[model samples]
Target: MTLLAGRRVLLVEDESLVAMLAEDMLLDLGCEVVVAMRLDKALAQARTGSFDLAVLDVNLGDTRSYPVADLLFERGTPFLFATGYGRQGLEEAYKAVPVLQKPYQAAPLKHLLTRLLMGEPPTREGTGGGPMPCGCHISREQQPFQVDHCS
Candidate 1:
């Protein structure tokens, strides 16, 4: 019923709980999700699987997910980075790739996914088309469920 219905999405996140939550969101959006909790597994999936889009965590424990991003780039796959660090977290080469600032919200996630599916090139501008500094900003209580701007 949504633009993402029946779409295949590769979700790469190091944290288990975050990954689970994001998987749930994707499932709710009617997407077939493949999750990679480590850089190696993510790289393998990027090499072998076909995906409509991918959401990659910038930090994967001891490593960064840029290699996976590179592979996806080579494949011409449309993917976005999910990080608390906004566009500043991305390397200079990948600044233009869309970013889903953590913690992920269903609405923004849905919006970005729809944009990618529609073949829209994500700009370096903030998720809402406004500029923001860092992407991560939880409430004073530090609730992990809080949704930050996805730039």
Candidate 2:
């Protein structure tokens, strides 16, 4: 079985099609998936749900999913952003989080989640508390989020 087998994952995406596609990918990876299509619903889940990981959409139509990210952060839950804009879309406060560039493919998604679930340090690319490609710096005081492993 894959590392993702039997894991519980929270997937927050505003678009129905994208959600379905991601859910299918996760299911194929043998994960138990929980889906949230709105900010409020995602918040509620993030606040109380027991999940091994979460994939959050940076944009949720009229709102952003940063609040959900904050909640997950406080809980020490590992999550990554899924966006078409790549890392460029993230705000300064969240630049360190791993991002899954959109048009989500099954292969890269599996690779990232597997690496994360295995307790490997997230590949931060150029955002390792250094200046981004855009010449913006991420604060060292902002601790990187950790992924909790399932027993």
Q: Which candidate is the best by lDDT?
A: 1
lDDT of each residue in 1-151, candidate 2, tens digit only: 9889999999999999999999999999999999999999999999989988999999999999999988886776777788888777888777767777787778667766775665533323353443212111323344242212111
- TM-scores of all predicted structures: 0.80, 0.79
User: Candidate 1, clashing residue pairs?
Assistant: 127-151
Off by over 4 Å in 2: 120-151
**lDDT per residue as tens, model 1, 83-134:** 9988778777677677788988997788667767665444333433332232
lDDT (C-alpha) at residue 128 in model 2? 49
- Give me the displacement of residue 83 in model 2, in angstroms: 0.3
Give the least accurate 10-residue stretch of model 2, judged by summed lDDT.
Answer: 130-139
List ranges where model 1 is wrong by over 4 Å. Answer: 120-151
What is the C-alpha local distance difference test score of each model? 0.80, 0.77
- Give residue 4's error in model 1 in angstroms: 0.3
Total clashes in model 2, counting residue pairs 3 or more apart in sequence or in different chains: 0
In angstroms, how far off is 36's CA in candidate 2?
0.1
